[model samples]
Target: MKKLAIFLFASLLGATAQAAEYVIDTKGAHAFIQFRIKHLGYSWLYGRFDDFNGSFQYDESKPEASSINVNIDVNSLDSNHAERDKHLRGEDFLFVEKYPTATFKSTSYEPAGDGKGKLTGDLTLRGVTKPITIDVTHVGGGKDPWGGFRQGFTGSTEFKLKDFGIDYDLGPASQTVEMILDVEGIRK
Candidate 1:
């Protein structure tokens, strides 16, 4: 009976040392999902998805255990131009009516020095799932004035539009798209 009690106590201590999970704070207005793609090989066109929600598990003590998942509303894309936004949501691009959401699920996290890391995940876009890697930088984490614990991170990745079946060719400008994510999470 004494041995059993000691084993249970050890198990509890180990669990307490594990990572904590956090839910993405959608209401904070600090989280953003932005994109930039070349236009006509002359300039870059910028856009953002206004609606997204996600959660992450983070362990400062063991950063490799950290993982994240996010879902973005395709129809919420905004490019600052109504016409362009509409076109982007149409069949020529996202086809939001048929495939309304894009998602990312982290498979691995490799921490780099100075609060940076490479996060590799499976990205599902336009009904296709492909692996992608994002360079991540931990912005910071702390307690908020509202008495909530918060953490923030920034990540960026680039991919070809055609890789996810977005094959609309707008000349040289249609090849690649750069995606950036500024995410904040609240401890649950």
Candidate 2:
């Protein structure tokens, strides 16, 4: 009788549970979008976007019910140098004047076990839309002062620059670019 009573209570708790809400912290968050390719086959050069914003809806019980939305300012591209940043904003690469923002929205998510999962989404950059998959892991979750709850998540994804209409010829040294995103956002 005791075992049956415990089981009934557990089922009631599960049925009444709801997913939590997390607020994304833009100030504390970091979005590192980077890429590189062959530059005359000599060495690989890298660059990144310095500013961006986004948020996500995460429900561990329902992985497929999750989603993410992110927007990146194309003009914020920085290659650690002024000249390169200017060139990247021009018609050759991102064409910041034409398309001011790059965005991504997740279509679905699936847990791969051990707090890791796959997030597939449509990424739009420089007027080109492509499907991208990101490997994500839960960094941590907790509450801060001021009665606010937060969760941190980090994800990484890589793709060819040419596939996104970024066909700038950087010589034979760089042919493909590997992009990485080290993001930490509060769930809201």
Candidate 3:
């Protein structure tokens, strides 16, 4: 009986020490979601989504168990030009009226050397869901001055607009869009 009790307590301790989950600090400007696409095959047009929220689970001891999920507000797209932004929010592009949000949920994590990894997940945009892989680099992680633990990462991926049903053509220039994500999360 004594040995069994000890074993159960040790197992509980090990489970508690395995992984920690963190909530993305969206309200504190800890995340940035931006995209860029070629314009007329000449210049790159850049834009960002103003509002988004996400959360992640990090297991330093078992990095393979880490995962992330994010939700972006589609109507908050900004391009620094009101006209262009409005058009992007219209039916020809994002169709924010119908699909007000985009989402990504990590399905797998493959670690590379030096705090880098390949994150493959399902990205849903414009009511279409597809698998996309992003290369992610862990920036750093530690306890913040505010008495909270934090972690950050930057990732990027490129995909064709037509894959997500955004078929608007701009003279063969807007076929592909490159998305970059910088995210920071606080331990919950």
Candidate 4:
């Protein structure tokens, strides 16, 4: 009877499990937000935001219920060229003076097994909000050297340049931009 009672208790506990909450480890430089766009149909221009932070909730048992939120500093864009970076920050592109921040809030997650899924979220940029879907892959998760648990994920999404109302005319080949996000979160 005691054995049966213990089994029933364990079953109840398992049924009540909840997702683990985590803060993106930006302070540790384990999180990054990057982008790539065609440069005049000749080559690709890659850049990354130096300042961004976020958090997420994930549970291996219920992956579909995971969620995440992130905020980015628009002025933190770096493209390795000072002149181009300046132009990108002006009225032609980001216009950081007017819109200094961007954000993403997850709406849903669809698991596809093998640590892959599609994450749909509302992305706000340049004062406009639109739904974007990211293809996400769970990197791995385990205990850190400091004895804290961590989870990591990599995701990518692409959207048309004009979708956010920044129609600076980058030509037909540069009509889209792709973003890559690598997030490692410490369990909280």
Candidate 5:
């Protein structure tokens, strides 16, 4: 009987020490995935994926064990211009009809210091999967007035357009695109 009690206590402790699961607060519009690319080697074109959802696992005790997964609706991209947005969705660029979705699944996290880290993942875009790294920073965390605990993070990265099978080149200066992501997760 004593051994059984001790085993149960140890199991409870182990469960408490494990990572916390969180759902990205997309319904509140508190998260974003934005991007920018040079336009014709002269100006910049900025846009964002307006529809995306994801979840994450995090633990204060073992930050390196964190993980995140996101799915993006490629057709939901908005650049604030109608004609250009349509063109971007066509075969020359994203080809949204054939590839309507994109995704990112984090494989590892490396803490750098000062609440910042390197998040490496496999990004699947345009039916191509490639490894990418995002420089991430822990924005903040706390309990909200709605009686929910939340944590936020911001990340940025840049990759060559050709790397993701996007070969529609405007010019040499427009070979790469920069991406920025912000997420706020509510503990579940």
Candidate 6:
């Protein structure tokens, strides 16, 4: 009888320790957003956004309650080529002068097994907002040597630029672009 009481007490303590509120530290975190599109029906041209900021609250047990917010400067588009980068920010593409930033807000989450899930959110680009779903995987979360709680995550999503009014064409350049995001957040 004493052993059973001890076991229950230990289980309660373990559950309490597992529940923690993690604050995402933006400075300690890194986010990379990359996209690839078919260029001229021959090859794919990959590009990425260089400047962006985001934050998220995550709980492994209650992932559905997690929320994410992100902001990306449209002018930060980098295609590696100078001319292409400028053109991408021009009126023909993102039109950075009018809409300087794109944003995303997560609204729902669904489990996909093995620490992975589907996050559905509203993505706003070029003044248009649409619901997009991203595939997300939890890389793991733990404490750093310096005492910071860090969490790692990866996500991927895709959409067509034309759907958001980016109708510029580069001789068969695919309108659809596949996007991938690698993100790490630290407890605030």
lDDT agreement with native, every candidate: 0.93, 0.76, 0.92, 0.94, 0.93, 0.84
Tens-place lDDT digits, model 4, residues 1-188: 99999999998677545788899999999999999999899999999999988899999988998999999998999999999999998888898999999999999999999999999999999889999999999999999999999999999999997999889978899999999999999999
Model 2 deviation from the true structure expressed as Cα RMSD, one decimal place: 5.9
lDDT of 3 by residue, 80-186 (tens): 99999999999999999999999999999999978999999999999999999999999999999999999999999999999999887777767889999999999
Identify the candidate with maximal lDDT.
4
Predictions: Cα RMSD each: 2.9, 5.9, 3.1, 4.8, 3.5, 6.5
Model 1 pairs in collision:
none
TM-score for each predicted model, relative to the true structure: 0.91, 0.79, 0.91, 0.90, 0.91, 0.84
In model 6, which runs have C-alpha deviations exceeding 4 angstroms? 1-29, 171-173
Overlapping backbone residue pairs in candidate 2 total: 15
Candidate 3 versus the native: TM-score? 0.91
Off by over 4 Å in 3: 1-17
TM-score of 5: 0.91
lDDT per residue for candidate 1 within 1-188, as digits (tens), equals 99999999998778656877889988878799999999899898999999999999898888888999999999999999999999999988999999999999999999998999999999999999999999999999999999988889999999999998888988975699999999999988
Pitting candidate 4 against candidate 6, the one with the higher TM-score is 4
Query: Per-residue alpha-carbon lDDT of model 5 for 1-188, expressed as tens digits?
Result: 99999999998788656988889999999999999998888899999999999999887667788899999999999999999999989888889999999999999999988889999999999989999999999998889999999989999999998888889868898999999999999999
* Separate clash counts for every candidate: 0, 15, 0, 0, 0, 1
The alpha-carbon root-mean-square deviation between model 3 and the true structure, to one decimal in Å, is 3.1
Off by over 4 Å in 4: 1-17
Error of 5 at 103 (Å): 0.5
Q: Could you tell me which residue pairs clash in candidate 5?
A: none
Q: Please, what are the lDDT tens digits per residue for candidate 6 over residues 1-188?
A: 99999999998787655545454444544668888888888998999988888778777886766778889987989999999899888899889999999999999888888989999999999999999999999998888998888888888988988889987776655878899888887776
